[model samples]
Target chain A: MFRQSLAVTLINLKSIPQRPGMSIATIISVALVVGVLLGFSAMANGFRATVQGTGSQDVAIFLRSGAQAELNSGLSRDEVRLIEEAPGLARDSGGEAIASAELYVIVDGTKRSSGTDANIPLRGVGEDAALLRQNFELVEGRMFAPGSNDLVVGRSVQREFSGFEMGEEIRLGNNNWQIVGVFSTGGTVFDSEIWADLGVIQNLYNRGSGVQTVRARLENPDAIERVRAYAENEPRLNLDVQAEQAYYASQAGATSDLIMYLGWPLSIAMAIGAFAGAWNTLYSSVDRRTREIATLRAIGFSGFPAFVGTMAEALMLSAIGGLVGAAAVYLLFNGVSASTLGGSFTQIVFSFAVTPSAIIAGIVMALVIGFLGGLVPAIRAARVPILAVHAD
Target chain B: MTEDLRQDTLYQLDHVSKSYTRGKERVDIFTDLTMQIGRGEFIAIMGPSGSGKTTILNLLGGIDRPSAGEIAFKGQRIDNLGQGKLATWRAHNVGFIFQFYNLMPTLTAIENVELPLLLLKMSGKERRRRAETALDIVGIADRAGHKPRQLSGGQQQRVAIARAIVADPAVLMCDEPTGDLDRESANSVLETLQLLNTELGKTIVMVTHDPAAASFAKKELHLDKGRFVEREALA
Candidate 1:
């Protein structure tokens, strides 16, 4: 039986090149499905990498108790000072704790491509801001001076927005801030913000002596729970404390989950169309080969060989389509930079990442479609009567 | 016909009846049809359309079951066998030739001939050798590399005959084998069938509308409405 099946299967596959029109129809349909599925998944993966890359386990963030993000949180000068003095924080060479009381606000900026106003994040940071973030480095020009209305634009902000070149001036509220430098934080969300003096930004936003969040470097990674307990128990600091990694990871979920939810149904719908095409192609193939199948059965090749032969043809076509689609996506979309609005109500730039797992998933999905598409037609082929050989 | 009858009978059909249900109506094709076939006999069944001649061939080859009868091949009841078992029986005991030359178009002449042997436990080399031998016997060994479309109708029928005999079955059942061929092609196919019977001693049962093709068989049975009206020995 195995030998008979193998013979029939090889013969059926050999006939595919002779029927190029029908074979190509199935291959192209499945390719389109796999391409769309992998494309959307890559976008979601890239967004996750950008958002989650901003966090570190050795750093902790302090936000107001009921706030969901830094943009909505606030702390007064005394509250910020009290949280900075708490234990388990790393210190600088001069013995001052490495903590930054940061302020976050959104301002309107023109996109370079459209010249239309979009919300861009304007962050306020103290002098110790660069010290707290280990990944921060100035890629061009000089850092913003203290007590000056100077701005250091992120690398992504410099590339995506208008009028943010070094030495260029942009008005925010009533003050004009000069773009003095460009900095990068290893493709994190911080690469999408404009940084300025903490006091200058607080006064410009009219929130005197108040900051939105406090980011501090932890002396040890395991000291997170201790810091959390201290902030929850201290009456002077009515705040919530969490590891920066957990906080950014939570933020990453909202966007990635939304993409997945919207992408799944679309991918499924495309897959259904591809499956229907395959089913139609196989049905026509069986119809054209009815007499040949009947002859095989009459020649003592049983129904099992006939059925398996049809299924093998369908699976082979689907596999070819899957491989072509996945290769196209990886070559054309991987590491392609794109941007979309995130949880912070500002554009976050990221690259489209076609991970290895996504390709495997696409191929597996193709096989599933192939199986479902070939089932009915294969059974129909196998059920062809041996007596049909006598039919005129 | 009775003088040439052999004592070793191969097939026995007793009181056979076949019917089909056609859209709420029972259409009876044949009733009370009885026949006996002996080993190493070449018989031709001739009748008008719908006279159940092809049905008898199908039943004898184990491709179909009798509706109400006992069909015994070699003293074994074949009418009650399941589909899978009947297939095995047909594979080992029967060969079939069709009017349309139903060879897989994707395969060459040798590949098509080797098809039946693929179901048997044989090595590739042996299968190839046997297939070539069958083709050589049918006088088409030179066309072994040609596909069905690449060959003439007469040549294609020759390849089909090679495929039928490659498994060395006890019976070769042919359904209108030359019905679609030109007169010359039909003569060639009939000559090949005659050689397979006379030289190789393969028992043959054929259904044909052509009286000339029927003349090649050793015995001709005229059937009307599923009953034998006349039987004649030709040689």
Candidate 2:
């Protein structure tokens, strides 16, 4: 039976060279479907990669007890001081605890190229904050000087946001802050923000005697649980402590879920269109060869063999379409950079990754559609009356 | 009782009945029909429209089961056999030819002939050899590689004959075998049928309205409204 099916498959493949247009159309339709599906999947992958890549095992994020993100809550200046001075906290070269009192605010700004106005995150970091992230590097100009009205713009911020260039001054609530330098963290979510002094941002936002969040590095990475326990027991602070990576994970959920959900409809609709195209081609092939099919049955081919042959033709067509679609996706969308919001209330930029997994999925989908579309037509062909075999 | 008469008795039908349902009415096509044929016999069934002559060939070829009674080939009952077994029995024993040459357009004459042999577990080369032999017997071996579209009506009928005999079945059944041919083509097909009957000793059952076509056969069975009204043997 398998051998018979293989012979039928080969025969169908031979027919493709003669009808090049139909073959090309099938391939193009499949490619379009696969390409769209992979596009959305890549966006999700990029967002997850950006956020999950950000935090280290040693760092932790401190927020208010009921707040999910920094934008929704604030930690008082006294709580920041107390958390920084807590035991088990890592100390820098100057013997001060390695912690940063970070302030976050959404500042309305104009985007570059299109100049569309959007809200961009403005992060205020303490002196030790830069040292806490090992990947952060100044790509151009110098770092922002502490105690001055100076700021450092991330590379993505400089590219996407208007007036966010090195040495340029951008106004934040009537206070003018100079963009002293441009920096990048290679990957990770920090590559999409404007960083200034914590006190400057707190005063500008009128959040006196408080910071939006307190982030600190542990002396021993495994002491995260003890730190969480300690923060939970502190009756005065009412702080929420979590691993920094987990915090970024929460940031990734919203955009990732959206992209994944978008892929569902896109994949389904494309599969239906491609399936219909395949069904049209395969049904015609069966109908056109009605006499041939009857002749075969009359010549002693069992109904099973005849049916299998017809379906093999459809599957071969679909497989070809799947390959074409995968190739198109790889060529057009792989390594494409895109930006969206993250769980930490910050913008993240990453590339459209056409992973091997996505390609396999597309092929599977194509084959299934082919099977569904081809099986019924094949059966119909096999069941045609023997007298009608010669009617043609 | 004689050896010659016994050898001539290749098939027998006893008390056969067949009918079709048309709306609320029962259209009786054949009833209490009885028949007997000899090996090496070239027999023609002649009848007008609705005479059930073709229905007799269909039943004898195992393509359709009778509504009642028995059809026997070589003294064994066949009408009541299960469908699966009937198919296997048909494969080894019967060859059917239609008025229009039903060769697969996609296949060459040789491949068309080779189709019946596919049911047998033979190598492709063996099937091709047998197909060639069948075409050669039908006197059109040179046209084996030509597709059906490339062949004349007579040549196409010859290819159909080749396909019918490729499996070396014992009985050959043809329905309006020369109905779609010109005078010359029809004569050619009739000659081939005569040769198959005389030289191969095949038990042939042919249905035709054309008396000229029937004349090629050694015997004539006359049917009317589903009954075998008369039988005539020609020397």
TM-score of chain A of each: 0.94, 0.93
Model 1, B124-176: lDDT tens digits are: 99999999999999899999999999999989999999999999998999999
Please report the TM-score between candidate 2 and the true structure. Answer: 0.86
TM-score of 1: 0.94
Per-residue alpha-carbon lDDT of candidate 1 for residues A152-254, written as tens digits (9 for 90 to 100): 9988888888888888888966779898999999899999899999988888788899999999989988888888888878988888888898898999999
Interface RMSD in angstroms for candidate 2: 2.8
lDDT of 1: 0.88
lDDT of 2 at A24: 72
How many clashes in candidate 2?
3
Worst 10 residues of 1 chain A by lDDT: A126-135
Model 1 clash pairs?
none
Q: How does the DockQ of candidate 1 come out?
A: 0.73
The C-alpha stretches of model 2 lying farther than 4 A from their native spots are A1-35, A108-115, A147-151, A158-180, A269-290, A344-346, A378-382, A385-387, B1-8, B135-156, B177-190, B209-222, B228-235
